[model samples]
Target chain A: MHADPKGVLTGVHFLDGDHACCEGTLAAGARFSAGYPITPSTEVVERFAWRIPTVGGIFIQMEDELAASIAIQGAVWGGAKAFTVTSGPGFSLMMEHIGYAAMTETPCVFVNVQRGGPSTGLPTLPAQADMMQARWGSHGDYAIIALCPNSPQECFDLTIQGFNLSEEFRVPVMMMLDECVGHMTEKVVIPEADQIEVTPRRYTKLPPEEFHLFEPREDLVPDMVKAGDGYRFHVTGLTHDERGYPSMNVETQDVQVRRLQDKLKPLANGRALCETENLDDAEVVVVSYGITSRVAQRAIQLARAQGIRAGKFRLISAWPFPEQRISDLAGRVKAFVVPEINLGQMVHEVARAAAGRAAVIPVSHAGGSVHNPDAILKAIVEAAR
Target chain B: MNQVTLEIPYEIPVDAHNPVEPFLRMDRMPHIWCPGCGIGTTVNCFTRALLDSKANLDKVAVVSGIGCTGRVAGYANLDSFHTTHGRALPFATGLKLANPELQVVVYSGDGDLFAIGGNHFIHAARRNMDLKVICVNNLTYAMTGGQTAPTTPDHVISATSPYGVFEPSFNLVALAEAAGASYVARWTTYHVKQLSRSMEEVLSKKGFCFIEVLSPCPTLYQRRNKMGDGLDAMKFYKQVSKIRHGAPTSECALTKSGEIVVGKFVDRDRPDYLELLRGQMTESLGDRYAEPEVSCSC
Candidate 1:
């Protein structure tokens, strides 16, 4: 554990992706973590359970994912930056509450280290199959923020980003990590405490009597006050009014749903939205995210070195589907390639974004192995020709 | 025995202003509950219990699973979570452990707790987690339009059991006591005052405490059983219940023909899971506990 003298992320060290993610959670100011241990994601809870107490925080092994998610929400409401880590099965268990978090507009982070599944498909293996589920698994027309990290460093960095997004938007942010990044060991720098920027939830500055839990601010995010603060507020899963009470009126539901959707839409147009590489003079754009993005990047580089005009757009925030960027790239490129571990989830989104400007082709795999860089490169070359 | 009407102090005001008025959307006031549903009674008892305990209002986290009783959290003026079906206990367990200072309560129905979440229910009790679990048993799944539940009597008819249910019902008090709940008690809606008092006592208890209230589901259980109304259900309780003090917790069971045994069945000391965890953490970390140890080693 030698520290680098240069001080540019000096404490960087090699650790499995899961441990790195755990460290990233702590770096992001997560003081309370509650989760039931599940395969491929258990290491994260184990790491946090051991690490949190040292920071004068709490970590609890809940009875299940339902408990874990609720506990994390409780911690967040208790004025702590809280998170829960789980995988496919656990994510399925957590979907109902995920909608609850959205409806309540609670600021919390859920790290779903993806594995294959509809139900416990591949417990210890990597799979990016939960992309759609992460965005729309919960029952409702609410907006969600989902980030996919391709490497251990990204796992550490994006978790911080996830917490930030959750706090900033006052929404539950999901760090959609997979087994590849979650288990692979890599060099990750743990920034100094002073170097990290941690954003706590916005508390109501108004008097307790005047505070409204669901009233949107100028930014569309509601002010949250912790429980036990003597502020009385209602929270429910049903479509609600400004005061957090359920209102079945269609107009109220429409207004409330739109705000939840719009609050996250602007994020897709901004800095942390998407990352593009070599798209200027490229004839083919290979779009991908998560571990598949790493392969896509390699594929594009290989194609570019071979004199084929190939570009890459790694989706950082996958949910509000980077339609504008993909549309822009489609006009510039002759074709678009989407390579993913799943059969054809993100490809549909890419196809929608590409529309008629570029021919979109899916390079998909749902096996034990990841989508290869060679296959993606071949797809790019074929499209270029 | 002194006929003492225990004063169950309530946190939410019962006055003209309506304590829940600020949180309640008055237009949505006519909730979905049938008239004389025990859910309202249970909700009243819960709010009163929270108030009597003087629990930190801001730190009170109420979580409920899907059921008629699960709506208790929706009506509360607190940090409430209306979670997925049968998973409220786990969520409450998490909430309690996350903020040990916060008062975490699990308000759920019999089906939510004993059927779908049965595994979590027993395990949470066995761990003796610091939580207040209020199980409102209406004998059937009233929310899904009258389905047979785990707590449904052996000869009860419902949507799933158009013919009378053949399975014997769970003895929740005995189940909780055996599972290691530090506090275990049972009371029917007929004993609302006693139920409220029992809830107050359980709320004040330090370890995992469970109170099973025999709430009446007039629209479902009552209607199906050919019981006329909520009053008829109360009459059945009055005629059948035999309060035997010092009765063994394991012996308490609810049967269609058997006497309803209602009372505080178990109360004893057990180290709560959180305190035990803290002790283990303090012992392991020792002086090196204040700051996080960065591990650069893979």
Candidate 2:
């Protein structure tokens, strides 16, 4: 589908990551958004409120994050591509609705401009501490897509992909941006409307009487109908049947929960987004993401100059972990050095994927800032030994 | 008092045929509401009102938050969403704003609306988003088993308030009026005839229209407080109710045994959210801004 011309800026301009993200959302055809402003993430919605009027979209500052989160789902069911933006404290409040969107299979995006936090630790600085929380924050068994953007340009580019993946999978997609990337100024190129590709909402062509709200097609994803489309369908947060009514049997629970997990299983490796460099004969591999990946590049160069064999692995998609690539590298490399802007989050996944075949070293930061290149270079040198 | 269109029949002719069945998911019944529960009656009145108002059923969508009355979304034969606890208003706000053509209705309970969802309730009304809200106030969180509710009158016995509810209850009518609802009414279940007529009037009106239906929870609220049964509550409404049309919202607070004011207190027109948004955008942004197309992505 062609992007809505009104929303597409269609030009190259110097913009912050937050402002670029708003442009990306507009180009993706999200006509509605509800949010409560939180730091670092606030600029995304602020820019949106200013530009959305020209594009004929609604940007509502809801009561709080909980209302913001659930409100977007309602807009989705009403036939609008919608999203919400928040930081850690707001993201924590939105966890239940994230699970609600997962359980009900609502297609939306949650942009978390992460900062240091156990609880509101550092609102002004950068941190990737919410990586694990983004994947497993919501209770119950469900998997969602999360993408990490390292630059203001990727903040615009990846947001388009995030919305696409969210629509394709019928699940909430997380745009994991740090406070640094969200605030940093850079040139962002927005493609023209015709050049920009959008996956339009897949509305069911089935008649109202024949439509079963939760009944999936052969693709294993059910087609959607908007509210007031005369479907008169019922959708609930409780464990529901194919008819979208609450059913408490063990059989129904198994079917419903299994489908939520199964739908994204294939996308784990097939649609996994990452960048790799010089891994063919590396003695040690560095796995990194977010702004840390940019810093890791410098570390890899420093290690190579010091007569150490090092390669770089930059993760663009943070969840549905690229286990296939990581596991394959575990057999070839002597060790894997994982550096993230948090205290050992994704390193656990790396360790699990490596499964004792190679030594896994975690370079943890207590957040509030990104890792120094030397600290990562030190870990790469140590892992190489 | 606002005019009730006398041309429209307030009650359904049950003897001729079941007019309400077509408006309900018949297979989903018998409903989960306990006997003597006022929700069933409210649902019936809602269905009748929808029919009487002559609104297009295809363009109506119902949204509900968690609690017993929240189940109305599931039972309604409409494009309905049973959303999260205390979030029906925002959900409806999202739906209504995104699809301005659709008639959005928020149907839920006191705890869902006034307690956990209170912030949304006030903000939505303050914005004057065009939505129809039907709140079944049973005085307690009946779904959670006789828990103290925001509408639980002082001195009422509840499971959470084992001795007695020492906290004062919310004056819902006052809250709605203060928060800037364009249409606000309060009626007990015993006034089904009047309540149904009120629904008929409110359904077609614009802006934030609210109807607080004082209901009875036979199993939890009544049984715990020794308020007899649902029948006793109905009789109690007849005894203590004062049919005061256009009463001041401040004096309309419900007490344990005080005379309950029941009538339409507010029904005046003002620019809704969408209207104000369009006006501001057209005035400020001018040629740069365009209104959204009606048949969006259809």
Candidate 3:
């Protein structure tokens, strides 16, 4: 389904990553947003608050990140596509309700423009340190979809994809952009509304009496019933049955929690969005995502000039790990060199997927800035040996 | 002990006039409330208000944070959301703003609303978000076994405050009034008729409306204090309660074993958060602003 044409800003323009993210959400049929101001991520909501009015959406600046996170879920339940944004500290605060959204199967998006962390490390600079936190910050065994955008252009493209994935899977999708990409200005080409396909909310077709909130279809995703629709359905953060009532038991817990994790498996398996180049006859593959991909590209070129056949594997969707593709390449290549803004985060996943089939080299950066090309080039050279 | 009753074709006839079943998830009964708990009385009054208001029940969405009273959302036979601890107000705000057509009601206990969620409560009221917030101020965290709450009266013994509460409690009436709530009221669970009437009044209000029902937690709060059962608490409310409509919120603070000031305190006209949003957008953006979509997608 296409987005509501009125919300789609159909012209190409020079925009920063933050502005592109706002336009992308509008083009994805998002009519509601709740947020708190945090550096790097603040520009996303700032642009949203100013521009949402013209397109007939509401942007609420909530009291804190906790409220902001849960507020987006409320909007989703109330029949509008919605999102929230934060940096690391605020993202830490939002962890509880992110799990709530997962348990309730509330389709929404979160934009976390990462900065140096553990604690408010570098607000003005970039880091991918929160990559692991984004996957497991919320204390539960639940899965979420996260996308990594390499530039302003990908920021626009992937944010729209984030909303589509959230709605399709009924999960809180994260668009993990770092401060560098969020503040970086570049040209973004936005297609007309006709070309932008958005997955609208899947409202239930059953009548109110027969509609079951947690009853899944063959794909394991249940249909939704929004508030004020005469479908007096109940939704909760507790272990619940198909009737949407709380049912506490080992059996119920297993069923409810397992579904939350398993519902996305089929969607995640063959659906890792990435850009690959020069893998055929390559001795080493450099795995990177987000801003690190740009830096890694330079390292690949440098390695090629030195007569090493180094391939590029750039991740667009960072979560669900893209394990199958990585594992296949692990046997084909002698080693995989992973670079990220963080100190050995996504590289661990890469190492796990390689499963000792290939030697995994992690070029860890302590995070305040991007990796130096020479450091990555040295790893590329050493890995090929 | 149960074999005789089970062997008998034992089924008591249902009360045909139990008007509350339609408003509650009857299949989930008998409820978790203690036999003499005042929470039931409060729920009864709320159910009465819902019945009398004649509002579109489908358009109403009830939300609650975690606690004994938070379970009210689960029991409510409306579009209900049972959310995390201390977050009902902001969650309800999202519902109201996303679809202005929803009659969003936040029902939770004092600990959930005033302790962990205190920031949200003050801000939601400050924004005057259009919501009907019915808070059951049982004075302690009853669900957690009589722990001291933000509304726990000074000198009251609780599981957390065995030496007696040294910190003074919040005057919720004054808090709500000062925070810019458009409507504020207080009553005990004993005041069923008046509580129900206040709820009806709040349902039609256009901004944040708070009703504090000083309910008795017979199992936890009452038993810990040796304050007799629910009946004694009702009798105490009848004896010490002073009906003072339009009283200043400051004068309505509850004292330990003192006069309970109860009445409708503040009612006024004001633009809700969403209303102000639309008006400001229209004034600045003029013809370019598209109104937010509010219909529920069925």
lDDT of 1 at A194: 66
DockQ of every candidate structure: 0.32, 0.56, 0.65
Q: What is the lDDT of residue B233 in candidate 3?
A: 88
The per-candidate count of clashes, in order, stands at 11, 1, 0
lDDT, candidate 2, A232-326, per-residue tens: 88889999999999998999999999999888877778778999999987999999998999899999999999999999888899888999989
For model 1 chain B, the run of ten residues with the poorest summed lDDT: B289-298
Pull out the clashing pairs in model 2: A232-B78
Provide the global lDDT of candidate 3 against the true structure: 0.90
For model 2 chain A, give the 10-residue run with minimal summed lDDT.
Answer: A216-225
Among these predicted structures, which one has the highest DockQ? 3
Better of 1 and 2 by lDDT: 2
Question: lDDT for each of the candidates?
Answer: 0.80, 0.90, 0.90
lDDT of 1 by residue, A107-128 (tens): 8889998988768798978899
Model 2, TM vs. native:
0.97
DockQ of model 1 vs. true complex: 0.32
Give the per-prediction TM-score of chain B. Answer: 0.87, 0.93, 0.93
Chain A only: give the TM-score of model 3. Answer: 0.99
lDDT of 1 by residue, B66-96 (tens): 8898888777767777776787777676556
Fraction of the native A-B contacts that model 3 recovers:
0.73
